[model samples]
Target: MAETMYDKIWNAHAIVERDDGQTLLYVPRHIVQEGSRFAFEFLQDRGLTVRRPRQMLASPQMSISTRRRDIEEITNPDQRLTVELLIENTRKFGVTHYGLDDPRQGIVHVVAPELGFVQPGTVLIIGDSHTCTAGAMGTLAIGVGATDVLHVLATQSIWQRKMRSLRITVDGILPEGVTAKDVILTIVGRIGANGGKGHVFEYAGSAIRAMSVEERLTVCNMSIEAGARSGMIAPDDTTFDYLAGRQFAPRGASWDRALRYWRSLPSDEAARFDREIHIDAATLAPMVTWGTSPEDVVPVDGRIPDPRAEPDAERRAHMEKTLGYMGLAPGTPVTDIAVDQVFIGSCTNARIEDLRAASAMIRGRRAVVPAFVVPGSTQVKHMAEAEGLDVIFRKAGFGWGEASCSMCVGMNGDTVGAGKRCVATISRSAAGRQGRGSRTHLVSPAAAAAAALTGRITDIRKMGA
Candidate 1:
């Protein structure tokens, strides 16, 4: 049978297929974050140690002792239990080969491919929902929960039901101010949040072909928001070019051989997918979310949808609640909404290119709102400063901060204050996602810049070319 890219990767990693329809998939790379501490303790409680603790932990000796001490200390420190325990846990199971302050020490999804931990044809797993971010490198990567993390930790494998494939092709030239972020947001609005459930989405066509590797990563990173297990763009010159000369990428003679393999990882033209979606990128506009869900989005010039107009009581009620919480009324223009804060960072859209795009927009304009720019990695932060992007952001009234998933998941000390409205480029705007009771409107980097300048939702195209 002719198979799609998802099938090719999944079957390559499949170890055993059970009669009940679950397949044991071998995990080539397991990227973890601070939240994975519980999974380590769970394994310890069951007397099943990590098969290769050295591979996961920074120091095997320290890791064992830290785990033992953290379990006992958990009872005494209620307030700092997770924090202390996680810090200690990472010392034991974390990778010592990389430094936390290293540019590669930011979000796992951002660091993995940047350090070559994610490669073409690999089956990767992480305890993070955004693990799909790694799929940008032509790999099969998915997020698993804590329990599943324990499973993968103990056995280095996971049992999963094979998902069907969805091929999404976006063709034509992208209009000015229309970015990969807008493309994905538009797709989410059309398909709804649960539209791609139980499927892997393969992004292709001329528009995707023209996107940079960083742009492609921005698209694949949000695949989870659309209910897809993973998403990918086939390896091409852009992919190989980005990988070339990277710290962990293949070097010398090996580079040529690796490129050959990556080039062949794409699905054959005759390959078949379970479903297909075609989009005209030329028609996409600068998009922003008006409600809680990613699908509850529209173009910058669009109006808030009227829930009362819908016939389905359940759906209408949900929309009504979302609008109430978002402080939006039916038919109200999204561009008219005011923003108190602006954030331009996350594993989804905080790469160097994202910083450049935002910097270009904010170069001479002072922020009309409290805006902040955080790079995905410390390395990206330093590089941007070297290129004067950091100075540009600061001159525009934006705060430049250290990397580490800042404001993306409300982790660390970064957050939006209570009842404050924010224009953010980060993925996910769920209630309390940024901070308790904070209102978040999602937009692209350019949209975020425009919002910062006007202190309201504004169209990027209105700013300039």
Candidate 2:
């Protein structure tokens, strides 16, 4: 049978199908973040341990604490406890190798491909919604909750129902100032946020064909926001080229063999998807979020939506609340909105290519708002600094911060102040996300750069090459 990319990857990892219709899938790799500390503690308390104690302990120390019943509990515990528990647990049950800082320690999804943990035919799971980011590598990666995390940790597998396939084909060359961010945002706007619910998306067409692996990663990273279980682009030369020479990528003869294998992962032209969405890439413009949801977005030159004009009472009420929180008047021009900060980082846009694009725009321009850039990984940070990208940003009036999740979640002490609004490249704009009472307007790197210069939402096209 002709198979889609998802089918090839899913079948490769399928261990068994239960009578209940759920397939047991073997996980080739698993990733967790600081938020996973609770899961760790839960395991310890239950006497369930991890396999490969030394490997688990090798993970970087995360500085996170949780307040339980007014008592501060350190979730990570000491390295000794982490290692011992993992060793004990893995021995009791069984597990694949536990990878530490192994060059794949940043965001689980980002680090996985950078470190070659996600290959063309593999099943990857992580305790993060953005685990879909790995789908860019042609893998079937999905997010699981803490309970599922424990289950996978104990059994090295998890059960999942089959998801219908949705193919989103975007063709044509993108216009200036348009990007992968804009493409995904436009798709969300067209389909509405929940359009892809219960579906796995396969991105195709010339526009997708033109995207680099990093750009494709950004597109898939936000698939969850559109209610898709996951999203993937077929593996090709672009994918292999990006993976080649990476710290964890296969070399010499292995590289040739891997490339051959990756080429075979694409779907046949005759393969059929359960649903299809077609978009013209040239029609997409520089997009920005005007309200709390990713779907509350418009072109850079557009205006905020008026709830009073909405025909549905339920939708109107929702829009009214969003307008109030965003401090946006109905019909106010989105481009006229002023910003107090411009953040250019997050797993979505913090890659080296994103930094380079922002630097090019900010060069020789002083930021009118407090502006900053953060790399997605420690290695990315070092590479950018080595190439003098850091100097260009600092000279252009932006702060250069260490590699971490940074301003993406407003965690780690980096936050937008109360009542302050920011033009951010990060995903999500929920209330109090950047900080308590802080407002975020999501944009692309070019839009963020223009906003930094003018201290308002500005058309990135006007900035010029």
Residues 328-392 of candidate 1 have per-residue lDDT tens digits of 88998888898999999888888899999888887588998899887777677778989999889
- Model 2 pairs in collision: 49-89, 50-86, 50-90, 51-90
TM-score of 2: 0.89
| Candidate number of the best lDDT | 1
Every candidate's lDDT: 0.80, 0.77
Clashing pairs in 1: 56-93, 57-93, 57-94, 58-94, 63-92
Q: Pick the candidate with the highest TM-score.
A: 1
Residue 23, candidate 2: alpha-carbon lDDT? 97
